[model samples]
Target chain A: MTDTLTCANLSKSYGGVVAVRDVGFTIAPGEAYGLLGPNGAGKTTTISMLVGLLKPDTGTVVVGGADLSADPMAAKAKIGYVPQEIALYPDLTGRENLRFFCRLFGLPRKAVRARVEEVLDLVGLADRADAKLDTYSGGMKRRINIGAALLHRPELLILDEPTVGVDPQSRKSILDGLERLVADGMALLYTSHYMEEVERVCDRIAIVDHGSIVAEGTRHELVALVGGADRIELTLDGDVDTALAKLRGLGGVTEAVRTAAGSVRLIAEGGRYLLPSVISTVDGIAAVTAVEVVEPDLEATFLHLTGNTLRD
Target chain B: MRPHPVLALVAANLRRHSRDRVGLFFIVVMPFVSIIFVGMALGGGAAAARLPVGVVAQESDPVAAAVLAELRAHPDLEIKTVGGEEELRAGVRGGALAAGVVIPPGSTRFELVMTQSSGSGMAARSAVDASVGRVAGVIEATRAATSAGASPAHAAELVRRAQAASADVEVVGSDTASATPRGFAYTAPANLLLFTFINSMAVAAALVESRRIGMLPRAFTAPVRRGAVLFGEALSRFLVAAAQAVLIMVVSSLLFGVSWGEPFGVAAVVGVFALVATGAAILMGSLVRSSAQPSAIGPPLGIVLGMLGGCLWPAEAAGPTLDTIGHLFPHAWGMDALLTLSRPGTGLGDVLLEVAVLGLMAAVLLSLSLVLFSRRTRTL
Candidate 1:
């Protein structure tokens, strides 16, 4: 099947300053593609171009089959964009806000009521849909903001930092809901500075910085680019020195040391898979009380690629 | 069965406004209060003091002399004698005199002239008519006696003896010429234009708020074109202005006895002026950076323009230079159109120039505002 979204050589500038430059990517149906970057790293600018809110100075965006620059209405109709801010009428009830977007998107009158209700339920705000948005918590308003985008069931959902200021529980709910949508074959272009969120939600990740994508791959492939090793920490009830020696002797283990806390910290390739072997290898020498496998993740990859932390 | 985007946008804005109690009170209720207060304070109250009137008598007959004497004696009228009927008419039209009266040679017939635009003019007409009725009673009694075969001198003598023998009686005649409504009628139209334009400017804050809340950017992301968004905003302001104008027209006519002259003419002026106000509102909304900026600046700006446009006072009374300057604002033209329609025989055709000028103002303001708005949204 054709990709749900395809954009190439997307570049935008303002007054001799480039906001986004030559960013390219595609999301096939059912894939969760993430544009991972720090703030001011051109994620929003790139999303602006993709959603047709901003015209790229030099690029082409095609949504489904329609070119964005040439056939903006058709291209835009296929995109459901959730902006970073809670962009809704505060005086309107959550349900009212949803219904308004339904009309704005020109949903069929006969289906709008049902579609709004479905979206309200999908965003987990069904019980409080009658409350005014100003009365809602930030997370609830964010959910409604998301719900508004879903009323028309666009083929591709473009979310820019969907959970920037959300409470932990609401953030979990949002991520879970998004995962379900991706599983149901809706393509998602998620952008955020939050490393863990991208790791948990994205099927393919692109690390963006300085108006360009420096790296793009699956989670394992990205981590492999930085040649990062997982650190495995083990606490022992007996024979700590001997257990450290055995861990060093293991094939995947690159280095082993005993922490000041008396636990053995081992750096290894495929540390999570190496956990079973380490536990067994240490068994004959000592009693293993606890084990934690700190796997290599996109945070390290981001830092290695951009030489800056995600928060920067 | 999808609703049109522009209608949906308008409905949403109006709905939001309806839910705002403070905004509703100001937009819907305040104009009536202003009309009543300003109307009473200016000319509609029964306790209002005496008004000046001009009189021109073309004959030296007893009837004309008696009517002139009675008018001069009336407590409510401060009468001034002018050279001719044309001078009297000019005094009333120029607002130097409240009303004018002309008595022809050898005839008991009297003509009353009043500018329809002034509430004081109406009051002066009523006072002059009451004073003329007293002399009309004596004339009738004298004619009755003469027709009964009494000589002219004896007829006069008999009427004088009858008046001295019994309590005096007064007869009133109803031969009054019509003009535009005065007093509360004048106040209603003036306040309608003033409040509608002011309210339209104030609601520019809503547009600024929409931008602040990211509604404009979100709207741009939709399948709808940018023109739809601009048109929706313009239409919303137009509906509000038109609705306010209609409400004032209806309430003033029903409760205050305001006669809006020439329905089609009144409608034409109100409609075009609403467009002018809409254009101004959109332009203000586009130019202001913050919601508070419009609210803070709109009323004062509206009042200053209203003062210049003759809504607060007659521009003609403000002298030639100010009158010319007043026409620079659309308010003056709207007021002029409504005032012109107040004349008894004036029709829509008479005020076409005023309406056309207002329509052109609306076009230019709307075009400039839409271009700025489109650029602003595009950059968002």
Candidate 2:
């Protein structure tokens, strides 16, 4: 599938300060791609450039096979961007705001009412269609903001921290709406520091930092690159020293962690070999309750690659 | 990816503006109230209503009392005590008294002073001349009878006959049909000048808001040319100004019976005036980053310009230096053109120079705004 949006060597600077530097990435059609980065890691800057809101000092952006600067109208037609801030007029009603954007896009009169109702319903805001935006709750406003971008039925949706500053219910609704859009064959470029959200939605991700992509892969592919290790967590009653010694001495084991109590754990490249060894290492342990080895999640893989939590 | 539907957006913006309470209050209530107040203040017809003229006679002589009392008896003329000539002039200036009559220390003839404080000083001059003329006519009649040796009954008959005839005020060899000019004839046109300017300048908010909301960016993202957005915004403001000018004209002409100089000539002058206001507002608004600054600064700035332009008062009342300085503002030229058109028997030929100059001013302002807005956008 062709990439709906592409940026090569994208770089931006504000006077002496560098905001985005040498970043390159592409969002393929019908695929949900995440741009995961820390708060000040240039996520917003990249989105701004890709959307043609900010001019990049050095880079090329092509949206829907059209060069943004060279052929802007074609690019804008395919993209729907939900801004990071509440941008609609506060005094205007939700329906009124939607109609304005619809008109701005030059939508047909027959399609306008239907599209407005459709998007509002999709965002779970059909009931609040007539309410003033200023009177809406944070969640309701967020839904309406997203709904506005959906007015023109863009093929590619660019959501910039869509869940930021939103309540859990609203965030879920937004996430669900995004997923529904993608399922309907719309391509999405979703950016956020929330790794779980990225992992839940995106088929592929580019972990960005300092205006560049540090890692790019599927969730499992990234973990393998970091030398996949099983996270073996256990609870025990006694013999903490012996357990730590035995697990550490094992050939395949990478590290043996002992709790302040007698509980002990092991992390290794191979989970099968270390499981029995760990069980035997902790002798005389009371009520050895649980033993489970799971694949490294995107959170662990992200932390392993970036050496920082996604929340940061 | 798309072309911006500028006209539709502008229409939506206009719709929202119509409902805005703040905008409504300024566009509607301000003019309505000021017209009533200012119209009665400068008036014969029912606007700025008329200033109350007070008369005080230090002379308790029967002749002097009759003159003062005769003025008090005139219809629609409100009379109060006239303290002194200076005080009466001061009252007129302060808008308390339209005019005042002070009888000289011994002579029966009173000193008359009219205030040039209002849009037209006709109300003040007439109010004063009528009051003082009555007393003077009575004294003159008494003197004539005494010198001719007429009897008391004959003198009474002569004075009575003289009192029966009222003297009329002739301004520039023409008698005003009414005591003062009619409604927007007195106010609406001035307000038209004021509102067009204020509305155009305040439109800076729409520009600022677009920037803040990222609408500018999205608009640029469209294959839409940068010129389109610039043109769209300027066009929107100009359209608003035109609408305001038309609204004021219609209301003034239809409701207030205000006769604009010549219909076609007035329309041409107002059109250019609207253009000037539109360009000025866009240039100023683009210079500022925040929408709040434009709305805040544009009105007061427009008011100051309007004051100079003759919206608040006639520039003829200003000193020569002040008049020259006031012409630096487009409102001054616009108002001048309007005045020429409004005066009796005047037509397109009379206001031709004003129209040409104002049209040139609008062209310059529009070009300047285009240059400024483009330069700022490029730098951004």
Candidate 3:
């Protein structure tokens, strides 16, 4: 199957300042790719070029097999973009805003309503869709902003910091919605400054700093490049002391520490691969309610590559 | 078939603007208020609507009394009786009267006191001259008869006969058959152009706000062509300005009895002026980076242009310099067209030069504005 998106050696400069340089990446169908960077790290500039908002100074962007520079309209039509800021009419209701966008996109009359309703439901904002955007909370507006991009059912969704100012609960809801989209076989190119969000949601991640892509790979592959191992957190509903003792002796676990009540943190070489053995080992000792396989801290991985923290 | 994107954008813009109460006030209310105020101030028509002129007589001679009575009875003269020449001069200077006339004891020639700065002063002086001329004719007839050795009673009878004969001659106004607009005719179209042009320019605030909030950039992201959005914005502004002009025309015609001659000519002028207004508005929208700048600057600049363009008064009334400057503006050309039509027998053919000039103005301004606005959008 063709990749959902491809960008090659893209670069952009404003006067003397180079905002992005030779930035390139690709996303496969049904995969989630994250463009990770700190502020002023060329994330937005790269996404702008990808979506045809800004023409790159050098190189090409192809969306869904259509070369952007050659056929921009067709490429643009196949991609959905949710910019960082709320690009919405504040005086208009959520439904009105959706209707306007759908109409502007030139959707057929028969399909507009159905598409709008489906996207509204996808964003979990069907209940308050009649309220004006100005009356909405920041999180609600962000959700509607995402809903607007989904109206045309584009093949690849490009989101630039979709959860910038959202509260935690709303952030989780947004992430959950996005994950469902990926599961439904839609490709996503997500850019964000939040390391945890990119680590949690992305299948492949690219770390960008100082106008260039410093590193690009899957979470485990990136961790391996920085010579870091994964951390596994196992939560027991019962008999936490016994599980902690057994967790320490697990083969893949180099070290195990009891971090909290009923929980043990294990540093393992292949945490996700070791989950089955870890689960079985803890079975007789205690009932393991949940297991979280965390790849080596992306923040540490980023800092290792750039000598600066992601937040910086 | 689907509506064009430009039409959709225009509809949305019009809807949004209509919902703005402050904008509606400027569009609907302010122009009408200015029309009524300026129309009433101009006394609204012909000789019967002329301004008040004060008269003071040092002598209660019958001829003087007759002159005063004749002045009071004249259609163009609204007479106010003062005590003497001093009071007459004071009334003219203090703006208590348009002009004042003093009849000295045994003198037929009167002292006419008037302010050169006042717009109504010329009308008052003319009325005074007509009234004093009647008194002079009567005195000449009586003195000629008495010097010819006629009886006093006979001289009085001859003077009465001469006065009767003098009233028989018809007094036609110098401007009666000419194309100059008078009274409310002058105020209506002038204020209409003033309000619509300036109001259209001031509405650029909405565009500035849209650009600032990223709505303009967002619009460009749609599948529609880029020029369509810019055209949509210009069309919306043109429609608003045209609507304002029409509203003022209808209200002034129906309520204030103001007349706009030659329907096709008037419509042509309005259409072209609205086009100019739209161009100016878009140009303003492109030039300003913030809403505050246009909101603060547009209306005042419009007022200065309106004043120079002869909205408050005729361009001829202002001196040669301002009149030349006034003709340079679209408002002055628009006023020229409407005023030409105000003549009794004028037609579309009479105002063609003004219409053609305005059309050229619209073309040039619209092109310049479109170019500047397109450049700004391209950089974004």
Candidate 4:
């Protein structure tokens, strides 16, 4: 099957400074591929090049088998791009905004209204479709922005930081909606600095830093690359040295370090299987007040590869 | 098939503007309101001031009586037939009459007595001359006919027949020597050019807003050509300015008794000026980076240009040097065309120069705006 999007050695520079360089990736049909990066990590620039907003200095971008450089209109027609900014008419109603984009994309006149309704319903904005966008909440506006991109049902949807500045409830709703789209076989290229959000929605991820992709793989593959490690934190009422020493001796435990405030942090493989052993080891030496497990995630992968947090 | 991209842009602009209530009020309502205020202020003085003139005939001659009758027929003139030249001169000197005409007994010779200190006094003198001149021409025609071997009574009959054979003539408000356009006639066109151009600059704000909201760049991602977006913006401004001009034209005429001289001439002038305004709006849109800048700067810039172009008052009121400078702007040419159209006997052909100037302004400004706007679009 043809990849929905392919960026081979895509590089762009403004003046002497390279904004994005040798950025290469492919997204398959029905795959949710996350582009993980921090601010100014060239994720937006790469997305801009992918969306045909900026011409890359080198390499190629192919959208659904159409080359963006040679046939931009055809390529653009195959991909739906939702910008990081809310790109919509504030004065127009939600319905009006959808109808405008539908017509602009050259949808059939008779099909536009039905499609507008469908997208509005999909975004859970059918009831407020007639309301002006300025009256919408920030989350609602973002939903409409995404809905506009979906009107043509382009094979690929590239959303740049879609959940930025959204309330937690709204963020959950957006992530859930996106997951539904992916389940329906729509390919997604979700770019974000929020690793947790990406971890929740994306099936695979490519970590980008300083104008280059540092690492890329499935969630499992990437976690394994980062030593397939899980972190365990144990809060105790007494000293954690006995527990820390015991954790160090346990099989699959790489290291045990005592942190501030009578707590012990253990880096281990197969954290779920090691949980019982951890509980038994700490039973006598300290009263385990609290325990938490952090599985290997994109954040860990990013930090493991780049020696910095995704937020940094 | 889908509509042309530029037309779609224009339609979108129109739809968006229709929802902008405050913008609609300033563009469509304010110009006529300004005309009404001007009319109210000027109506009292101009409507009440009639030129009083004395007419004295020393003998009971048919020709002299005819002259007095003609002067009495003039709408702007109030005639007092005094008994003697002395009384007529005294009325003129005392300001009781603006001017007096003395017919020398039974002769065709007539003397006009008035100081040409003001335009109205000169207008009175001209009116009296025209009235008496008609009578003198008839007498001269009679004398010529008599010399050509016709009887005196028969000569007089020949002159009357000739007078009856002349074509019909229309007398307009500006036909008199005092060719001042009063009240709404002057204010309506001035404010129409001023406010329509001023309000149409709001198109710049709309353009900047589109850029701010990221709508403009989003449009470029579509299949439409870039020219479509630029033309769409220009068309929106032209339509708005044209609509405002038409509204002011129709409303001022219907509400006030302001006469806009020729329909075709008026339309040509307004259409050309609207194009010029559209060009200005597009240029402003291209130059400004922030949305609020256009809204803040457009009106003041338009007003300054309008003032320089004589939209506030007559270009004539500005000294000759300033009037020369005023013509450098499109507003001056537009105002000049409107002023010419408001005059008696003016036609489309009479204001060709003004039309040509406005057209040239539109062409130059629109070309420059296109260049700048396209460049700006590319960078975005």
Cα misplacement distance, residue B319 of candidate 3 (Å): 2.9
Model 4 / residue A255 / CA error / Å: 12
Docking quality tier of model 4? acceptable
Off by over 4 Å in 1: A229-296, A309-312, B45-181
- Superposed by TM-score, candidate 3 places the C-alpha of residue B336 at a distance from the truth, in angstroms, of 2.7
Q: Give stretches of model 3 more than 4 Å off.
A: A229-296, A309-312, B44-54, B57-99, B103-183, B313-317, B378-380
lDDT of 3 at A226: 55
Give the number of colliding residue pairs in candidate 4. 0
DockQ list for all candidates: 0.46, 0.21, 0.21, 0.29
* Estimated TM-score for each candidate: 0.75, 0.73, 0.77, 0.74
Q: Which sections of candidate 2 miss by over 4 Å?
A: A13-19, A55-58, A228-312, B1-4, B46-112, B116-184, B222-224, B283-295, B348-380
Which residue pairs overlap in candidate 3's backbone?
none
Residue B129, candidate 4: alpha-carbon lDDT: 70
Q: In model 2 chain B, where is the ten-residue run with the lowest total lDDT?
A: B174-183
Q: Which model is ahead, 1 or 4, in terms of TM-score?
A: 1
Off by over 4 Å in 4: A228-296, A304-312, B43-180, B257-265, B375-380
* Tens-digit lDDT track of model 2 for A178-292: 8988888888998876888998999888887776788898877877776788777777656557667766887778877774475666778878666776676555644466776
What TM-score results for chain B when candidate 4 is compared with the true chain B? 0.68
TM-score of chain B of each: 0.70, 0.71, 0.79, 0.68
Candidate with maximal lDDT: 1
